[model samples]
Target: MTGTDTDSGRPLPRRLLAHVGVAALVYLGVCAVLLVWALVVTARETTDASMAGVIPFLATAPASLAFLMLPANSVVFFTAIAVGAAVNAAIISWCTRALRRGGHPDR
Candidate 1:
């Protein structure tokens, strides 16, 4: 997917979005595997200090915040996650394109 088309010439964004949607599934699959690995590791480990800190933070921070501010933070977190996913998708797409163009047979 170069920015332009070979024949019918549809806008790149439409094509890119479709490609990204499919690619996102591959990304999600890898994430699911990692999540399962993390769960297995957590279950096997007797103690994890970083994980221990999360409960106190989640419990205390929300109670300390104003009710109105809580929703704003939730929106910000969701936006951040979306932005991060888009950036990751872009990087993956770029790398895939680059490798293909560079004639790396692995792809």
Candidate 2:
């Protein structure tokens, strides 16, 4: 197995980048859906619908780190989410790879 991958025949780093990209895209998609919901709420309820936009950040465990590290700004929030997505992807990739190796349960 390459240091990057175990048996998938793909480089681990590339897989990691792809995972990060897909995960970040999914996170952004959630943000977009929430944004749309916020817009709809704003149009219907005449309220800012702050919760709609903030829920993803507040609810997603990974993003909470970014949210806390940075200020409450849109660009920063998105960046933080993307960064959080990468961190999450890396962690998940590592965990899954470790599990697949099948050495010791305690390891």
Candidate 3:
């Protein structure tokens, strides 16, 4: 019945930005889960129990992100970033659509 799909009564661009923000939060949650699992596995296997173990686990996620070190090649590094952005955009689009459909059940 309304021109805008958002129940918050904001413009489309703002809604899109909110959708992207939510998607980013989801992305960080996934990364945090990966980081926690890595740390837990490291914790279980080690007998020495030194501070050095904690440092590497904490640094890895940011280091890989900053250096684009995955796949270990220049071309692959750029490709990975592109792929990641595309995936995040897809997630935002999906979330926006879900919000549109769910928020206006009368339609």
Candidate 4:
């Protein structure tokens, strides 16, 4: 039996929501890792006099691009992050819904 067969008893919206939660967690995990990496790099470069501190800023680019493009405030930063999470969740829901609808080929 295929994965879709197993989803027969469950509602699609519930499945989609579950997928959204999973996608949010995965997205947050990636952001958390990058944030930690940036912090570590910043700490290691503290004694240097180069422009390496920019690395942390670059690392957060994906999560904060909205804020960077805007007024660059805490509100904007949080908004960007929230928007990112929502977008990620929506994309995941769409893809998983398609998959559950048997949008795959079998050999």
lDDT (tens digit, per residue) of candidate 2 on 6-99: 6366778676555555454455566567655655775676556645556655534564574676667778766665565556655666666566
Against the true structure, candidate 3 reaches a TM-score of 0.33
* Best-fitting candidate, scored by TM-score: 2
- The residue ranges of model 2 lying beyond 4 angstroms of the native Cα positions read 1-48, 104-107
lDDT of each model, Cα atoms only?
0.49, 0.59, 0.54, 0.57
Candidate 3: deviation at residue 106, Å? 10
User: Which window of ten consecutive residues has the lowest lDDT sum in model 3?
Assistant: 52-61
Write down the RMSD of all candidates, one decimal each. 10.7, 5.9, 9.5, 7.3
lDDT of candidate 1 over 40-83, digit per residue (tens): 65577756633642332233233223333445454653343344
TM-score of each: 0.39, 0.51, 0.33, 0.45
In every candidate, how many clashes are there?
0, 1, 0, 0
- Model 2: lDDT equals 0.59
Q: Model 4: how far is 92 from its true place, Å?
A: 2.0
Q: Write one digit per residue (lDDT tens) for candidate 3, span 1-107.
A: 36555447777767756656666555645655644555576577766444433333343333335545455664654344445544555666677667878977665
Model 3, CA-based lDDT: 0.54
Candidate 2 clashes between residue pairs 3 or more apart in a chain or in different chains: 4-12
